[model samples]
Target: MSEKTNQPLRICMISYRSNPHSGGQGVYIRNLAKALCELGHEVDVLAGPPDPLLEGAARLIPVETLDLYNPEALFRTPRLDELKDPVNLMEWIGTSTMGYPEPFTFGFRAVRHLKDQLHKYDIIHDNQSLSYGIEKLSRKIPTVATIHHPMTVDRRLAVRSVRAPWKKFKHLRWYSFIGMQKRVSRKLPKIITVSEFSKKDIAREYAIDPSRFSVVPNGISTELFHPMPAIPREPGRLIVTNSADMPLKGLYHLLEALHRVSLTHSVRLTVIGKAKEKGGIEKLIKKLNIAHLIDFTGRIDHHQFVREYAKASIAVVPSLYEGFGLPVGEAMATATPVISTTGGALPEVAGDAALLVPPGNSNALAKAICSLLDDPEKRKQLGAAGYNRVHEHFTWKNAAEKTVETYREVIRDYR
Candidate 1:
């Protein structure tokens, strides 16, 4: 074992799929790796497609998979040569059966690659790829995993979102990988979660002891998400960063609130995501007759996203539940007052900086947005408060330092 010294530690971080545009996992990996490198540590990110966008001291190692979920191909069959690998074959079969296979297959490939080079790093940190292969890796190396939140929450919410038995069954099939995650999580010695709320929920859901967990709150990239004073804020223009049709994101409630608010006010909504053509969100939009009042920006770069937040009168996070509520912190970091539901760790992230509303309540959300829009003074106060709150509690530097501490502790115990 290498002795601890003033020298920086070599760390390897793994994520199954890390595309910043796809979701927060990519953002987390990109920023966290940058921060860790800034702290004088060497960091390498091993990820599958779509590749994560990383900078600073971090190096990206592409762990190629079948990538059956690529939007361009959209379930295109794999070539016969690719199917020679058992992991690739499994991934193709799993996707064919409507089950997510990235975690399992990615872990298999990652472990195989790392086995021969285990001596190159002092510790391994996994970004929620809780697979049996990870369990096998942990037995040989000092490994720690970050479970953002239990996928069981997503499964439960998705199952409840649809009424038809077939859709619910499909939801169950898609989340079958959760069974593997649950089994693997219990065997790992250290687990890092983003909030106290998530830590508790994961412990209960996975039936693991709370002592195995560490609550390290995620940080917003202040350099990117900070206020753009040059961009004039638009009055009566509400903005939300949602996953379109995901039930856990609570976009349905936000649309309903938009409908209610637009009845008497001249409010227009800009969604920072695209909706499926025939998905639940699109159907709801047409049914509620609010298609003309909303604009979906599809996917935008980080610069455009920050500008969008700066231009909005207010930012809303209407999630049914969140593991950390990165969107809430990002909006707050941009000096935009937020109206967020007290779902999961949202209130924890929002603190006293945001107007809290009940989850799945369109009426409450509408009222809160209207109240903020009508009172510019209140918006100013909340916005400033939120900015201060983020500066004090959430920063990449802080998260990286705390995460390194956990890494050191794990390394020492393993030795």
Candidate 2:
């Protein structure tokens, strides 16, 4: 509607889940909104399910969805009047059948919520919820979608990891919604992806022209993730952050590597996320007899997680695939040497500063860990390099500035 300028612009950010424990999307929303507000933009984050822990200048708009995974009331239903709309009814059925429906449902709700007040904001930014309803909103307002990475990559890796053909088939069925994402992503006029590696994968998977996408890397909150020079790291203590119990995360492999490392080195692994009681990771830890060597911290506060990072001699990102690798950047920002797998966008984020190993290869991971554990000089060099890399290239302020520029470019072209 108007030219982008030094004056503050009203912006609305949309996310299906803004829970920091859910995934990187929540952290992205929390930090980006704060950064944009710091840059003199009015920011509002409309989120569903889990609430985001955010500070001043950025407002939160909660949109409720039937959280089937909520521990207190699993499989609970929403009030009848709330589901009176025909589209909402369809979404409820779609989710009950077998496919994930929150993205589509949230998009429907977001469009209805913003339809009458379209003039209140300069732009609507969608955070990886590539729903058809998002396509509809793009027609009414200047919209930009940030795809962390393509879901197709996850489906592929999951299928590869499973032993049974039937299990592979089931994985395919669960990710069938990728078809809808592909359709919506192609139609969106503006897109902001986290890394160049993801830009290539998404363009290829969605059959879009590479030139149509823009790359704006996600940032690490240096305020929270920065190195603590006062606290000394414990000897042979390794840390890994895994948000989901998915095979694509490669945590199982990390557990195996840790088991091997313990034979020659007195090491312990501290996992910062939950591992289901009967999950693959838990079983593996027991089988390897590293149950005592591993300490699963379940979930911890942002400050405490960083404090754990401060105590870790090194952090490992053992994912089979990553769109942007926020954990790697976060560890790097904390001045912790990272040993990451060359899966998806990890190499792009790790750069040459951190040690790289092949995904799914536990032996290589063990070797890399042993090398880092033995060489303190190498660790010091990598830690410093990583810190400088993130500060120079991946702070939220820089990310917001680049994103704002992309927003202006898209609006100018659309107008």
Candidate 3:
């Protein structure tokens, strides 16, 4: 590809489900699209519900689908007219069978949308929605995929966390989409992952050669997650941002550590997200009898989320594994001392800025939290170090630039 032809190439970015409040994928799409646009690229985000809030984008083309997972109408059957569409029928059947249909159905819809519009864009970038439809779309256009981490890891963790025969079977069925992801990923020319750990894991899990993968670390939104020094920090206040019921997130382990810490220290634990209703986390909170000492804030807006970090004395990330730990970066960006697990890419993101603990080890988490809580000077030192690391290494502009380089490579290979 000519250097001038690569400059300001039209890009089409696809995300199956992208709501910033829902997870990190939304944040990744919003920030990356904005940053790419700022670099003189025409970008379009084609996504399914809930809609991703993108600012200064070329356009947000909503790829409609059967949003069966909508909280307000969870599992509601699709209308007769909608079911007439083969993709909608597939989604209905898949969801009815306890399988996630978004990735598959979204790809089907996306491919249909992009088929005729293929001439408008230079490259098609898929954000982890590895599906058969994407494989079909890729054959027609220059395409690359981002597999955050193998969903197989999540499935193994979730299945191992549960003991009941039926529940284990359900876990297996729910993650049946991993098979599709594996197949689609291997067929693609290039795969982009957020961390080196993810690149290794994806290669091994999908049996793909490591040479086909590119490692691009995710960026911390410094604009929103930056330090708020004017906001007074609350001593003995510990914060963790996670989806409480996701077994991979290891919230149960964190709760166990909180129980251990509260016995010796007067610490108040605040969870930034809610626990699944009647899920393992809720049951564990009751079983451990630490409900009184913990607070679940459900979901808060970005502004409030940053302030929450500013108010906290320390942040903890207790995930069993992460493709890239966004909470660790966000907490560090906010200048809060962090205690995180060496889970997957947490160490990659945290480096030496945050205290590290073993994954699924409550005692280690408790010790790190206590050590940081007791030493205000140490906390201050770590906070400053983390802020500097974020400013130096993790920025949306850098991530976008690296991503465009990969896009150019993929486009050149396709031709």
Q: Report the lDDT tens digits of candidate 1 across residue range 198-303.
A: 9999999999999989888899888888999999999898899875688999999999999989988899898987898898898999999999999899878878
TM-score of each: 0.98, 0.95, 0.98
For model 2 the TM-score comes to 0.95
> Higher-TM-score candidate among 1 and 3?
1
CA lDDT scores, all candidates in order: 0.91, 0.87, 0.89
Give one clash count per candidate, in the order shown. Answer: 0, 0, 0
Task: Kindly report which residue stretches of model 3 are placed more than 4 angstroms away from their true locations once superposed.
Answer: 1-3
Q: What is the Cα-based lDDT of residue 407 in candidate 3?
A: 91
Question: Ranking by TM-score, best first?
Answer: 1, 3, 2
| lDDT score for residue 246 of model 3 | 80
Model 2 has a clash total of: 0
State model 1's lDDT. 0.91
Top TM-score: which candidate number?
A: 1
Lowest-sum lDDT 10-residue window in model 2: 1-10
Can you tell me which runs of candidate 2 are displaced by over 4 Å?
Answer: 4-6, 77-88
Name model 1 segments beyond 4 Å from true.
none
Candidate 1 has its poorest 10 consecutive residues by lDDT at 1-10
